[model samples]
Every structure is written in structure tokens, then in C-alpha cells.
Target chain A: AAGVIQSPRHLIKEKRETATLKCYPIPRHDTVYWYQQGPGQDPQFLISFYEKMQSDKGSIPDRFSAQQFSDYHSELNMSSLELGDSALYFCASSRMGPVNSPLHFGNGTRLTVT
Target chain B: SQQGEEDPQALSIQEGENATMNCSYKTSINNLQWYRQNSGRGLVHLILIRSNEREKHSGRLRVTLDTSKKSSSLLITASRAADTASYFCATDAHAGNMLTFGGGTRLMVKP
Candidate 1:
């Protein structure tokens, strides 16, 4: 089975720079979710989209924005990046509807802000 | 703030021993899910228990949910060295599909 695919498995950026992370969800999956995991910390929900619409938001920073394209892929754009933003960014996908459907995760993109 | 809190920040056990982890949440949820992550890798979904369900089993894994206490537990039977990883419990609240994760329990299974 094809799993969710994240782009730029590893990214390095400097402070005040801009970066964009992309996620290609599994086929037929209509929901995409973004999460951040800092070293030795739990994963934090950032934002989510359902059927190409923003369905929920969590602790995502104002400098970050995300959108799901018509093809069901999503992109997370971070501007004015800060060193604190360095972490593992994960993308998960699930079919919308069943309450018991589990989220399928991608390998994630490691962002290192220098 | 995360919605769930997992017990035992870390655990070490020998292979063939059963490993168990507990999770407590703050709010009512539609379902609770357990996931495993190997070091520096993506999360792998293990099991999910609906709010109305008391227990569920998959392969060597068993998950129990107690809605009354807003708590859940995951047990891995006959654990192997391959089971060494971080386990996290996530809750899907009535609010939406966003899953709030717990601080994860690190399990090290020795062979």
C-alpha cells in the first residue's frame, strides 16, 4: 500500500528565512494533518485539512500557513523561521468519515533552523 | 497542552515479557488510538478503541479504553526486541479529527 509521502526528508534553513514543506497523502485519503515533534517531546498537532478545507487548527504559529491543493496534497509554508522551529514535521492522512479510522503517517521532514 | 498523559516515562524489559503502557486523557473523546515510532521514524498505527468499546485486540496487541475514567491502556504480548520503540496514545475528541497526543512512553525490549 502507498503511504503518505513527505518532501525534502531533511531541510536546513537560517533564521528569518522561508521554507515550504509538502505532503502527498495516500490515494483516496481526503484528510491531511500536520504535526511537529521536538526532540524528546510528544508530537503536537499543528493543523488539519478535510476535503481541501481547513477543518481544524492547533498550536501552529502565526508565521506558518498551510493549504490543501485540489489534488488532496498539502503544503506547509513557514516564513521568518526561527531556530525554535527546528524539529521533525510529520504529515498524516486518513479517510474522512469513520470515527475509528487511524491516521497513516509519513516518514516526516526534519527541519533544522540554524 | 496535550490532551493525554502516558505513565512511566520509560520502561525496560526482556524479550517475551509483556509490556504495558497507560494513558490518561483530560476530556471526552470519540476514540483513542495507539501508535508506535521507531527512533527517528514515522509513527505506525497500532490500534484504536472507540469510546463505546471496552477492549480491542490486534495480533499480539491489546487495547482497553475506559470512557468513565477517560483512560486507556495498551499491552503488547510476548514482546520482542523489535518492539523497542516509543508508544504514544492519541485521542480524537468530539471537537474534530485533530488528534491530541500523549507524551509517549519509551519501551526498550531486551533480547
Candidate 2:
């Protein structure tokens, strides 16, 4: 089975720079969720989209924005990046109807701020 | 806000011993799920128990939910070094599909 795919397994950026992370969800999955996990910390919900429309928002920062494309893939963009933004960015996908369904996760992108 | 809170932030045990972790949440939820992450990798779904269900089992894993107390427990029987990882309990509340995760319990099984 095809799992969620995240690009740029590792990313390095400097302060005040911009970065874009992309996600390709599993086929037929209509919901995409983004999460950020800092070192030695639990994953934090960032934002989510259902069928290309933003459905829920979490602790995502103002400098960060995300959107799901017509093909069900999603992208998270961060600007004016800060050192605190360095973390493992994960993308998960699930079917929209059953909220209890399991979420398929990608390996995630490791963002490092220099 | 984070929902589930797990106990014993870290646990260490010998191989073949059983490992158990507990989780408590604040609000009512539609379901609770257990996930495992090795080091810095992505999370892998272990098992899920619905709100109305009391207990569920998969392979060597057992999950129990007590909606009354808003708590849940996960037990891994006959543990192995391979099971060494961080375990987290996540809850999806009646509010929406977004899952609120716990602080996670780090388990280290010795060989």
C-alpha cells in the first residue's frame, strides 16, 4: 500500500528566510493534517484540510500557511522563519467521514535553522 | 490544547516482560488511538479503541478505554527490544477530526 509521502526529508534554512514543504497523501484519502514535533517533545497539531478546503486550525504560527490542492496533496509554507520553527514536520492523511479512522503518516521533513 | 496525558514519562524493562502505559484525557471523545514512533521517525498506528468500546486487542497489544473516567491503557505483552520507542495516545474529540495527542511515554526494552 502506498503511504503518505513528504518531500525534502531534511531542510536547512536561515533566519528570516522562506521554505515550502509538500505532502502527497495516500490515494483516495481526502483529509490532510500537518503536525510539528520539536526535539524531545510531543507532536503538535498545526492545521488540517478536508477536500482541498481548510477544515480545522491549531497552533500554527501566523508566518505559516497551508493549502490542499485539487489533487488532494497539500503544502505548508513558512516565512520569516525563526529558530523555534526547526522541527520535524509531519503530514498525515485519512478519510473524511469516519473521524475514528487511522491516519497514515509520512516520514516527515526535518527542518533545521542555522 | 492537548487532550491525553500519559503516566510514567519513561519506562525501562527487560525483554519478555510486559509493558503497560496509561492515558487520561480531559473531554469526551469519539475514539482513542495508540501510536508508536521509533526515534525521530513518523508515527505508526498501533491500535484504536472507540468510545463505546471497553477493550480491544491486536496481536500482542491490548487497549482498554474507560470513557467514564476519560482514561485508557495500553499493554504490550511479551515485550521485545524492538518495541523500544515512544508511545502516544491520541484522542479525537466530538469537536472534529483533529487528534489531540498526549505527552507520550518513552519505553525502552532491554535485551
Candidate 3:
């Protein structure tokens, strides 16, 4: 089975720079979720999209924005990046109809802000 | 904010032993899920127990949920070295599809 795919498995950036991460959800899955995990910390919900629309927001910073395209792929754009932005960014996908469906996650993109 | 917190920050057990991890949450939830993550990797969903269900099982994994106490437990029977990883419990509130994750319990299964 095809799993969720995240682009730029590893990214390095400097302070005040910008970075864009992409996610390709599994086929037929309509919901996309983004999470950030700092070293030795639990994953934190950043944002989510359902059917190409922003559905929910969590602790995402103001400098970060995300959107789901018509094809069901999503992109997370971070601007004016700070060193604290360094973490593993994960993307998960699931079907929107039934509740309790397990989320399928991608390997994630490691962002290192220098 | 995180809604769940796992007890016993870390555990070390030999292979073939049964390992149990406990989680406590703060609010009402429609369902609770368990996930495992190998070092520096993505999370792998293990099992999910709905609010109405008390217990569930999948392969060598068993999950029990007590809605009244706002707590859940995950047990891995006959654990193997491959099971060494961090386990997290996530809660889905009635509000949305978003999940609030717990701090997680690190389990090291020795061969």
C-alpha cells in the first residue's frame, strides 16, 4: 500500500529564512494533518486540512501557514524561521468518513534551523 | 495543550515478558489511540478503543479504556526486542478530528 509521502526528508535553514514542506497523502484519503516533534518531546499538532480546506488549527505559529491543494496534497510554509523551529515535521492522512480510522503517517521532514 | 500523560516515563524489560503502559487524560473523549514510534521515525498506529468500548485486542497488543476514570492502558504480550520504542496515547475529543498526544512512555525490550 502506498503511504503518505513527505518531501525534503531533511531540511536546513538559517534564522529569518523561509522553508516549505510538502506532503502527499495516501490515495483516497481526504484529511491531512501536520505535527511537529522536538527532540525527546511528544508530537504536537500543528494544523489540519479536510477536503482541500483548512479544517482545524492547533499550536502552529503565526509565521507558519498551510494549504491543501485540489489534488489533496498539502504544503506547510514557514517564514522568518527561528532556531526553535528545528524539529521533525510529520504529515498524516486518514479518511474523513468514519471515526476511529487510524492515521497513516509519513517518515517526516527533519528541519534544522541554524 | 496535551490532554494525556503516560505514567512511568521509561521501562526496561526482557523479551518474552509482558509490558504495560498506563495513560491518564483530562477530558471526555470519543476515542483513544495508541501509537509506536521507532527512534527518529514516524508513528505507527497500534490500536484504538472507543469511549463505549472497554477493551480491544490486536495481535499481541491489548488495550483497555476506562472512561469514568479517564485512563487507558496498553499491554504488549510476549514482548520482543523489535518492540523497543516510544509509545504514545492520543485522545480524540468531541470537538474535532485533531488528536491530543500524551508525553509517551519509552520501552526498551532486551533480548
Candidate 4:
């Protein structure tokens, strides 16, 4: 099966404009997560979804929101984007098995808020 | 907040040499996992060690976890140029499935 897929591989938007990024996790995977990576930095958690519910929210600003639909697709929305929003957004998925399951990630969407 | 701290922010080694990286974390954890990310790419799972286990091995990778000290170490045996990447350690807290990752250590394997 194809790995996780994210939309708008690269996006350039003017500040204050709204931007939405979409993701489709691997088929049969029940858990999905979103993470942000700044230049020369490690990935930081944004939020997580499991079984179509928001399992956890990370240290993101209120402008960021996410939704899990039917346990397959998840979308991350940013309103009134600021220059700080420029970074790589990654979508990850994993099957609910042993708690030791490792997350499988997509290539990620590069969003640049100019 | 995350519970782990990785040491030696960066390491440079010859392709045939060994590379060892260390991590220390606060609080008890269900498990600790290691990941590798190539430049501008998503992270790839490397190995995992449970709280109850002391050491685990996969192919050429060796991982050791010390619950008493709340520390872990990753050793890459006979590294290759392709092994150059940023390595991170993540902790799965005893109470949840979410993983809290540590600051990564970038490794450069000189060919």
C-alpha cells in the first residue's frame, strides 16, 4: 500500500491568508499525527488523532486546527498565517498494535508564509 | 514537554568507524525509540527499547536503555556514508502512547 500522502508538497502564501494542508494515512492505519519542522530543527508535535478523535494537542498556536475524518484522512488548517508559519509539515500514521508501534511519516508539505 | 535530552549535538566519523550517541530523559517511560532523518526528509524508525529491557539489537544497530539512570544510548556499528543523518530519541511516557522526542544529534559519516 502507498505510504502516507500529504497535499500541496510546496506552498507559498501571503501572510494573513488561510492555508489548509491535507493528508491521507496508510490504509488500515488507525493513528495519525501532525508535526512541524523548522529550518535546522527537529520535528515538533502539533497534534495527534486516533480513531477519528483528537487524541492530543501539541504546543501549537490557536491559529492551527486539525480534524480526523472516518479514521483515514486528516486535515490541518491555519488561519491568519504569520511568517512564523513557514516550515515543513509532516503527517504520520501507524497501526494500533503493541504500544511499541513506530510512526510512519509522509514526505511532508513545505509551507512558506511570506 | 518532552523527557529526553541527547548529547553531542553533532558527531563526525569515518565511514568504517563506529558512532555512539547518548540520551537522558526524566520520568519513567513505557519505551524509548530512536529515529533517523536524512536532510529534508521524514524520520525513519531505527530501533526501540522497552523500560523492562536493557539492550536491543537490529542489524547493525545497538540500543541500550537504563531505567535506573533514565538514559539510553544508540551505537551504529561500522557506519556507512548513507548513515549520515540526524538521530533523535523519543520517549513514550508510562501514561500515554504519544512520543516526546529529544533534540536530535546530527551525524556526518565521512566517506
Candidate 5:
């Protein structure tokens, strides 16, 4: 099975536009996570999904939402993108929500909001 | 506020030398993990040390945890230029399933 895959490696959008990022997790992984990283900064958790349900919601605004399908593919949707939302969005997957297991991450999708 | 904080915001070492980084957390944790991130790249897991374990080793990497003091250290032996990257420490507290990351330690290895 392939690793986590995120679509649209790079995107440029105007303010107030909507952007949807897609992710396909590896086979057999039940947990998915979303993180955002700014330039020269560490990644901050946004949200997570388990068993097609939203498990955790971090310090994200209301404009950000995510959905996990029956097949385990997840989509992160931004209803109204803002300049502050411009950052690298990363999709990650893990076998379970354990402290010891490492989270496998996709390359990331760079969103540019002008 | 962030739970984890790493000392020495940046580090520089010559090739074949050892590099050490420290992380401190404010709350009790179940485990602590280290991650490496190259320029413009996602983070890669390096190692994890549980609260019960005093030390853990994998290859040239050694991690030590002192839960009493709420601190941890990552030591990399024989570092190379490829090891040049930003390293982050994440803490998984007992109450939460999510891991919160520290600011980070930027390591620069000279060849």
C-alpha cells in the first residue's frame, strides 16, 4: 500500500476563496491527522479522525473542517480562506492513537492565500 | 500555551561529532518523542521515550527521560551533514491523546 498522499502540492487563492485539500491514508491505518506549518516553524495539529469520526479538534478556526469517508480517505475543507490560513497543510496517518506509534506524514500541500 | 520547550534554539557541530538537544515539558506526560525535519519537508520520527523508561537507544541515537524533573534529552552520535535539520520534541500527556510539539531545535552539521 502507498503512503499518505495529498493532492495539489501547491495552490494560490485569493482571500475569501474556498479550498479543499484531499488525502488518502495508507491501507490498514485507522487514524488520520491534519497539521499546519508556517514558514520556519513547527507543525501544529489541526484535527484528527478515527473510524470516520472526528476525534480531536485542535486550535483551528471555524472555517476549517474535515471529513473522512468510509474508505478512509479524508478531505480538509476551508469554507472561507483568509491570508492567515496561508501555510503548508500536512496529512498524516497512524495505526492507532497511541503515544508510542509514530505518525506517518505526507509531503504537504502549500496553500497561498493572497 | 505550548507544553514542550527545547533548549538552545539552534545548534552547530562538526561532522563525526555528537549532538545533544534538551526538551522540557510543563505537565506530566505518558511519552516523549523526537522528530526531524529537513528544509521544506515533513517531520520524520526519530525516537520515543516513555515516562517509565530512563533511557532508550536506537542505532546511534540515545534518548533519556527524567520524569521527576520533566525533562528529556536526545543524543545523536557521529552526526553527518545529512543530520542538519530542525528537531522537535512532542509530549503526550496522560489526559490527552494528542501530542503537543515544542518550539524546536535547529541543528546544523558541518561537513
Candidate 6:
């Protein structure tokens, strides 16, 4: 089975720089979710999209934004990156149903902001 | 916010011994799920138990949910070193909603 795919297994940036992360969800999956995990911490929800529309929002920073394309692929754009933004960024996808379904996650992108 | 809180933040056990982790949460939920993650890796879904269900078994993994107590547990039978990882419980309180993850329990299985 195909799993969620995230680009740039690792990323490095200086403060005030911009970075964009991409995600390719599993085939036929209609919902995409983004999470940030600090070292030794559980994953924290950022934002989510359903059917290419903004569905729910979480603790995502104001400097970060995301959108799901027609192809079901999503992108997370971060501007003026800060050191606190350095963490493992994960993308998960699932088939939307009457009840929440399990999420398929990617290996994750390790972002290091210096 | 319905965040799951795991007990005994860390556990160490010998191989072949059973490992159990507990989680407590506030608020109502529709379902609860468990996940495992290796160091610096993506999360792997272990099992999910609906709020209405009491106990469920999947292979060597057993999950028990007590809605009345607002708690759940995951038990891995005959654990191996490969099972050494962080275990987290996540709660889905609503349909089509994101899960609230617990702090996670780090389990280390001795070879």
C-alpha cells in the first residue's frame, strides 16, 4: 500500500528565511493533515484540509500557511522561520468517512532552523 | 481540549514480558487509537477501539477502553526488543476531527 510522501527528508534554513514543504497523500485519500513534533514530544496538530477546502485549524503559527491542491497534494509554506520552528514535520492522509479513520503518516521532514 | 495523558512516562522490561501503558483523557470521544514510533520516525498505527467498545484484540496487541473512567490501555504481549518504542494514545472526540495525542510512553525492551 502506498503511504503519504513528504519532500525534503531534512531541511536547513536561517532565521528570517522562507521554506516550503510538500506532501503527496495516499491515492484516493480525501483529507490531509499536518503536524509538528518537537524533540521528545508528541505530534501536535497544525492544520487540516478536506476535499481541498480548509476543514480545521490547530496551533499553526501565523507565519505558516497551507493549501491542498486539486491533485490532493498539499504544501506548507513557512515564512520568516524561527528557531522554535525547528522540529519534525509530518504529513498524514486518510479517507474521509462518517467517522474519523486512521491516518497514514510519512517518515517526516526534519527542519533545522539556525 | 481532550488531550490524552499517558501514565508512567517510561517503562523498561525484559524480553517476553508483557508491557502495558495507560492513558487518561477528559471529555467525550467517539474513538481512541494507539500508535507506536521509533526514535525520530513517523508514527505507526497500532489499533483503534471505539468508545462503545470495551476490549479489542489484534494479534498480540490488546486494547481496552473504559468510557466511564475516560481511560484506555494498550498491552503488548510477549514483547521483543523490536517493540521498544514510544507509545501514544490519541483521542477522536468528534467525527471528521483531528485527534488529540497524549504525551506518550517510552517503552524499552531488554534483549
lDDT of 5 by residue, A1-114 (tens): 488899989999999999999999889988888999988777898998888998888877898889999999999999778998989998988887545477788889999999
Per-prediction DockQ, in order?
0.76, 0.72, 0.71, 0.55, 0.60, 0.68
Rank ordering of all candidates by DockQ, starting from the highest: 1, 2, 3, 6, 5, 4
**How would you encode candidate 5's per-residue C-alpha lDDT over B28-109 as one tens digit per residue?**
8888989988877777888988889999999999999999999999999999999999999988763335678888999999
Q: How far off is residue B90 in model 1, in Å?
A: 0.3
Model 3 CAPRI quality: medium
Model 1: per-residue Cα lDDT over B1-111, one tens digit each:
368689988999999999999999998888889999999899999998888899999999999998988889999999999999999999987545789999999999999
Order by lDDT, highest first = 3, 1, 2, 6, 4, 5
The estimated TM-scores of all candidates read: 0.98, 0.97, 0.98, 0.95, 0.95, 0.98
Which lDDT tens digits does candidate 1 get at residues A50-90?
Answer: 99999999999999999999999999999999999999999
- Error in Å for residue B40 of model 6: 0.9
| Interface RMSD, prediction 3 | 1.5
Evaluated on chain B only, candidate 5 has a TM-score of 0.95
TM-scores of chain A, one for each prediction: 0.98, 0.98, 0.98, 0.96, 0.94, 0.98
Q: Kindly report the interface RMSD of candidate 1, rounded to 1 decimal.
A: 1.4
What lDDT does candidate 2 reach at residue B8?
76
Worst 10 residues of 4 chain A by lDDT: A94-103
What is the lDDT for A88 in model 4? 95
True contacts kept of 1: 0.78
Q: Per model, state how many residue pairs clash.
A: 0, 0, 0, 0, 0, 0
Interface root-mean-square deviation, candidate 6? 1.6
TM for candidate 3 is 0.98
Q: Give a tens-digit lDDT track for model 3, residues B1-111.
A: 378689878999999999999999998998999999999999999999999999999999999999999999999999999999999999988445788899999999999
- Candidate with top DockQ is 1
Q: Following a full C-alpha superposition, what root-mean-square deviation does model 1 have from the true structure? A: 1.0
RMSD of 3: 0.9
